[model samples]
Target: MPEPVTLRPRGGMIIAAIALVIAAAALVFIAIDGGLLDLARWAWPVVLLGWGAWLLYLRPYVRVSEGFVEISNLVRTYRVPWGDIDSVDSRFALTIRTRGGRVIRAWAAPAPGARQALSTQRADVTHTPGDDDTRRPSDAEGTASGDAAGLVRRELERHRREGTAAVGQTALTWHPLLIAGTTALAAAAVVSLVLPHG
Candidate 1:
């Protein structure tokens, strides 16, 4: 069996983490300089920064294994078996439609530019078979989402032909720990805002 493919927004996540670190450092400096006494004034912006950090760094990812595709967003993770997948589309989002009429979007892999997608599709159709020597890199052919979607399509097709079984029965589940952690962080942020500053 081939190794699973883990797909996430590489550049955006890195940038968001860097921004969060800078924001946090600045916050610390302000606190040491006695600017925290006026924390209420800038608290909301800090909250916004935290939210952005979570959205960018924590929100979405897709793991495609031989038998299943796991799509995780903020609170929920959907594990769809290859056999259950009706189709995969990359219109507004990287959407997977199940045979039972369930449509789940992968938050991690957002759609690429439409023009780029179209051009890549054209290239694939026009390119001759057994032309690996002439083929361009995956980056040149499509966006990250497009590349991910293609990978998923290939795996699903392979599994469909071989009649692969589901790895586990459960699907469309949430990570309780992640939910609790994020909730706690949000509550703390809110509490700090309402509480009096010393």
Candidate 2:
């Protein structure tokens, strides 16, 4: 068996904690400056509350071994055998379907270094033509058909068959909802702090 492949989400937990801290600090600054409370009556408090909730609830780790896949968030952990996986698919999220038909979705793939390590393991597996192991032909024709959906399908199939898949790098997702929500909350806190009250 190949060396155990461990794929962790990019960025140490420390970074995420730090980011939360920075965001919290910014909220504090906004509140003291009377900006948050002014932005919206209840927004800032809500944002802070949500942020805290996510930080407390979101456990973000994905680990794949020769025998099984392990996923954990701040709240729970799941372990599934490779053979139990029915299919893998990637859309807005990456999902693993089990023979029982239950689906587990991950926010994104593992990091680059982790992916590279997994790719190295692929060399030993008997990869079907349509299997994920088949690398895209470097020629133009392959590129033409290599659309996003195709890539996602290919990746899912690859991991399902060969027991490996690429992991996405860790970075700010830039999700609009999260950004807007955070902004709203921060603004509300500031406004509340600033308005004069008798």
Q: Which candidate is the best by lDDT?
A: 1
After superposition, candidate 2 runs with Cα above 4 Å error: 1-3, 8-18, 21-58, 108-198
Tell me the whole-model lDDT of each prediction, alpha carbons only. Answer: 0.68, 0.47
Residue-level lDDT tens digits of model 1 in 73-111: 878999988777887776556778888888897778776
Stretches of candidate 1 above 4 Å error? 35-48, 113-140, 165-170, 195-198
lDDT of 2 by residue, 1-198 (tens): 245444333444445566567767666766677665443444455457547545433445555555556555444456666556665543333456767777765532321243433443333222323345443321111221122223334444556678564343222223456557656767766776676643
Tell me model 1's lDDT, rounded to 2 decimals.
0.68
Worst 10 residues of 1 by lDDT: 128-137
TM-score of 2: 0.39
Residue 109 of model 1 has an lDDT of 74
Each candidate's TM vs. the true structure? 0.72, 0.39
